[model samples]
Target: MHAPPSPLEAERSDGGSGSVRIGVLVPLTRPGWVEAGHHLLAGIELAGREVNDTGGIAGRPLELVVRDTAADPRKAAAAVDELARLGVAALAGEYHSVVARAAAARADALGLPFLCSSAVLDALTEQPTEWVARLSPPQSRGWRVYADFLLGAGHSRIAVAAQPSIYWASGTRVVRDHLAPRGGTVIELDMNALTPAAVCDALVDHRATALLLLVGHPEPAVSIVKAVRRDQRLAEVMMGAPAGQPEFAAWATSLGDDGAGIPFLRYLPERLGPLGARVERALRERLAGAPSFVAFEGYDTITVLADVLRSHGTDRARTAESWPRVAVQGSRGRIEFSRTPGISVWQWTGTPVHVVDRDPAEPGRFRILHAG
Candidate 1:
């Protein structure tokens, strides 16, 4: 069996001699994301333990300096400064776009390498800095992928509901732009300004075949689905959301049968590899529940960091320079980074995203519609 994680003390600070410290930034107590933070931390700790057990980076054990972002931008920025003060070699693990943007700025100012674990905001990468990189695809590309799925599914008239945040707004624009040329009608709806009933009215007026949600939370997404299901005219309309992927349970429980046909993006595979299967089993047995995609992201972040440190040692400059060149076969898929214009620098362009939906026959299970 693999070894358990190091003591809590090790997570707070460096514990042993010859240990390379990597700062972990996660939201543990955010208003709606406490559970998400825990899952991400679980995956990070698991990978760190495995790295340490397998002779660490050049025989130096990997130490994670865990810090809670709390879904606050200022807190995330402060945490980066704090972790740097604690002598961490690199910064990793942030799920929120706002927090990731703040952490990335702080890490850049501190001259520390920061690898964003799951934040997808394009602005996070748009900043000109070699110190920042992301494991998730830009929201624009992710939205485009979803748009392609809609077109492939014969959804010509799609209603777009998006969060006010640029993270969602930019992606919404991509979807509209992609569909306009294909003779597909995209009616934009303000998620904050319009009630679910109003959105439903708009969808019906437009004769929309699908509703695309680009949001950061599950509330409005669920509310809209519940609203859509309540109307017979909208019953035939497909409701798809990218935000629901992270909070599948919340969506499923809140909407029940209403969530069956809806599709959302997620990174985890229905079936795991041998290593991933073992990790999942161990996490499930320990946590008394199944793991989520955040867990997989956390695991892979550490794995990539370990690989980078292994090849480049602890020199911050060399490590940052080598980030674009670093590649590892992570749990999700081939983990690699490349600089793309309009995307972020050193961003992981190969994130495995699949459109998943709840199976009507088996409510607990999911059905993958398309892999991108």
Candidate 2:
């Protein structure tokens, strides 16, 4: 693969004409969280439209060259290659951590600037690189907060219904490491071998007071929740999904009240500020329903990228260099990027973190249990 064009070459490549195109990587198809993709895309598209409506980047239209990753790392890497070849000024939008990692690696290798929209994995790149930056809080930070929530809720004996994946593994490790020092024990129930009934049985055997769903939605996650809720032996066991699976509507549609009261991590404040409230209204109309934190993350990604592109121009190298200087107001808060310890990308440390769950009395309403 050819290395990305230098600032001068990139400036000339566009011929100082036409739309300012950004390569958008999102999972819009199956095997990829489709609902999450829809919300993400909605936020991105809304922001892109707003940018163009307000004169766009330096009087040129802002266009998004979208590619569906389908939650596959290989597919994401290929998409990065294709987008780079297509001469996109920068890359944006991805919801899955593993897939985003693959894209970030490829973008770094080819010297393309990638403003990751979601994907909270701490090590986005093998080593630090200016080519990549992220909007989501890292798994370590989010899961550590989750562990604290577990401990504060008086559930020291925790069990994780985990699948085999790097993202899940990292989350499990973060929770384990955080809880270990505080006298909390985390039992890993491998989903590969255990059925939903078997998971409940393991909870009973382990005497775990809380069972976290480290698996995917609708299949093992939904099934495990149903099984645990139905099994009288595990009725008192608190259920959780630290990865924010329950933030989407599909979780409620699939499990209803069974899905309610299951706390999960969310990257949103308890109340939306002025900007957040305005974006929330727009996104709700665009989505025809309540928007998840993923949607806000998507909006913020475009918001930040648009700011950079406007101030720094669309040169790939220049865009990457401008990460640390970024200071744009997003729906969530004052968005800024800085080098966070152990994180390889320019991270927005100010992103709000909340532990929330759907109210059992009203499944549509969310209740914030904790904030960090």
Per-candidate total of colliding backbone pairs: 0, 0
The sequence of per-residue lDDT tens digits that candidate 2 reaches over residues 252-342 is 9999899999999999987889999999999999899999999999999889999999999989999999999999999999999999999
Candidate 1 lDDT: 0.79
Which is the leading candidate under TM-score? 2
Number of the predicted model whose lDDT against the real structure is largest: 2
Name the regions of candidate 1 deviating beyond 4 angstroms. Answer: 1-18, 216-218, 269-271
Clashes of 1: 0
**C-alpha local distance difference test of each model:** 0.79, 0.90
Cα lDDT, model 2, residue 275: 92
RMSD of 1: 3.7
lDDT of 2: 0.90
How does candidate 1 fare on TM-score? 0.90
